[model samples]
Target: MTPDTATPSLPPTPPSRRAEFRFDGDAREYFRIWIVNLFLSVVTLGIYSAWAKVRKKRYFAGNTWVAGANFDYHGNPVSILKGRAIAVATFIVYSVVDNFFPKVGYALLLALVFAAPWLVVRTLQFNAANTSHRNVRFHFHGRYPEALAAIAPLIVWPLIGIAVGWNMSSLPASGTEFFILSMPFIAFAAVYPRVVGALKLFHVRHAAFGEARFALDLPMGDFYRIYIAAAVGAFGLLIVGMVPIALMASLSPLPGLMVAWQAVYLGVAAVFLAYTRSHVANLVFNQARMQGGVRFVSTLTTSRLAKIYFGNLLAIAVSFGLLVPWAVIRTARYRASCLALESDGEMDGVLAGVSENVGAAGDEMGELFDVDVSL
Candidate 1:
């Protein structure tokens, strides 16, 4: 309508804000805490490690800030300790079974297979319940059926391998037999990327920050493409690395060639690891959203990430692992710098409705495996 016939105008929508993500942690401060934790853990024969983990989580969460508010971790050390004890006990039992009763090892193995999905689901729920920003906690609603489906590869692949090799009463006497036995393992390797992608989907897609759940439409097709690209890149790097080594072997001594081969292999592995991590981070963050209007951005470059990893490795080695606290802090800070959240409104408002506590049992897998996915 023209101005003559128009009613009162409404206010314009506010432009979105780019919420800054910052890490307020200081290496010196963390180092002091780390050293104390280490000493206490050792003094207590690793029992204090439970409390140490809680402190470490609290430290990181307390220091991480977005939209002028720091996040918080409310995980109990007692729960974590209990989880660790359970994990250790299970490991001991599994080890005993493998050592003494080879056939019964399958039963123990199947036990773990059935337990994997539950552990993962609980771990996600627990960690999400404990983590909070603006007094509201995140939550994970992944169910056992969904989790089982998502983690089937980890469960089924091993079972298939065991089934295929269960009759290995003696070493394979023929090449054909050896080839037949290895097929299950080969198939597992081929499907491993898909399994990882499924896990990522389960962890990320099921997460809810307040009432607004996360949505990631990263299909298996997309995930497979990313993995395929990374694999091809790694293979190319390996080929490139080996070509010169093969040609120059004639000019180098046997020991020198061996050293060169080792160096090339390690270098390729490092580069591949860095490349995949950076690429995956950028891909996932850019594609994912919390609610509809809240999105994430990642500026992590492969070169930058690789440098951080290489530097951290060197520094840790140089310090005989004493400087590990510094390395951890350094990596945390840099990674924080690479991420920013763009949202249509205040984040506190978005988080207002999402407050929850999943409980100690929810994060057992995280506590047990130390899978820290703080993004």
Candidate 2:
């Protein structure tokens, strides 16, 4: 056939490239920073902790690289300190009222319960706004309504249980009462996976790097199956662990048996936690997508995570917590190594969006109160 008459071939598909995350922070270097931060925080009566936190976050963020570009933290220490002062004042008032006026304390607790969802949204916004990669700022558009929707079930179930327990003395001592008391727990467990899925959806879908929003196209059933599988595995391990614990208890002294019991229980708990964290994170990250033909991949293994946890525990015990910086660095390294971003084209194709300043109160409050505002 003539060359002009031959059918034209289609263009070849663009090759996809996977870039693993990198952490260049050294443990020894971090330890020096950590020790200084600790000493200053102590000397300042914890007022300098806000600056210390900023330094620590900057160190970690500056060292974390993806696609040959490192991230940066732009948080203001003054804003963080202001937030911390407010949080501390609130805590002090709550503590004093609870000690002197139990009824008023309950009212304050209720107010806090309602305010938590707002704090969660603001915390996410602050963290995202302060984080930048390749000069493009990340942002969180999550609002109070979405956060409330995600957390309402968690609050409701516990409130129901509390209501029932409050009236337990008045209720009849029958199987009906027992069933009624147990219903909240059963309902909570049944909805826990879906609640978690909603939280993840709210978290990922509202996150934006530049002008592009992240997407999670996963079914709630996937989360349910993972949680159920983790629970069943933990129960099986617990049963197996109990056998050894029982034997040791029967054959050993009281103190030895107590130690054995604690060891077995802690081991089971750690295994369960490792499985949930690794599997849930892997599923969420692997299913997340962004613009410019980019997607994420996570290879977090439960066994490796469990080993790390146990090793960290042992090292912390041996070093009297002096090895904390080492533990933190190693964990960060391992987690980064397990994660990668895949793209069919250049990552620079995505355009940047306007960077807006956000308040640090939510971030500081969440940290002060040990609230889980993490995405």
> Evaluated with TM-score, which candidate comes out highest?
2
* Cα lDDT listed for each candidate: 0.79, 0.86
| Deviating ranges (above 4 Å) for candidate 2 | 1-7, 161-190
Structure candidate 1, residue pairs in collision: 122-362, 126-362, 126-363, 210-354, 211-354
lDDT of 1 by residue, 1-375 (tens): 546875889998878989878998999999999999999999999899889988999999999999888999988899887777778777788889988997798888788778777777878877888888888778888888988887677665778767765777665678778786777777776776677777777778989887888987676776667667877887998899888888888676466887777666766676777777777778788888998589999988888777777777778867999889888998889889989999877665674455455545435544555433333
Model 2 over residues 173-255: C-alpha lDDT tens digits? 78798789888899789888887888888889999999988999788899889889889998998889788778777787477
Q: Judge candidate 2 at residue 188 and give its lDDT.
A: 85
- Backbone clashes, each candidate: 5, 0
Window of ten residues with lowest summed lDDT in model 2: 157-166
Residue pairs of candidate 2 with colliding backbone atoms: none
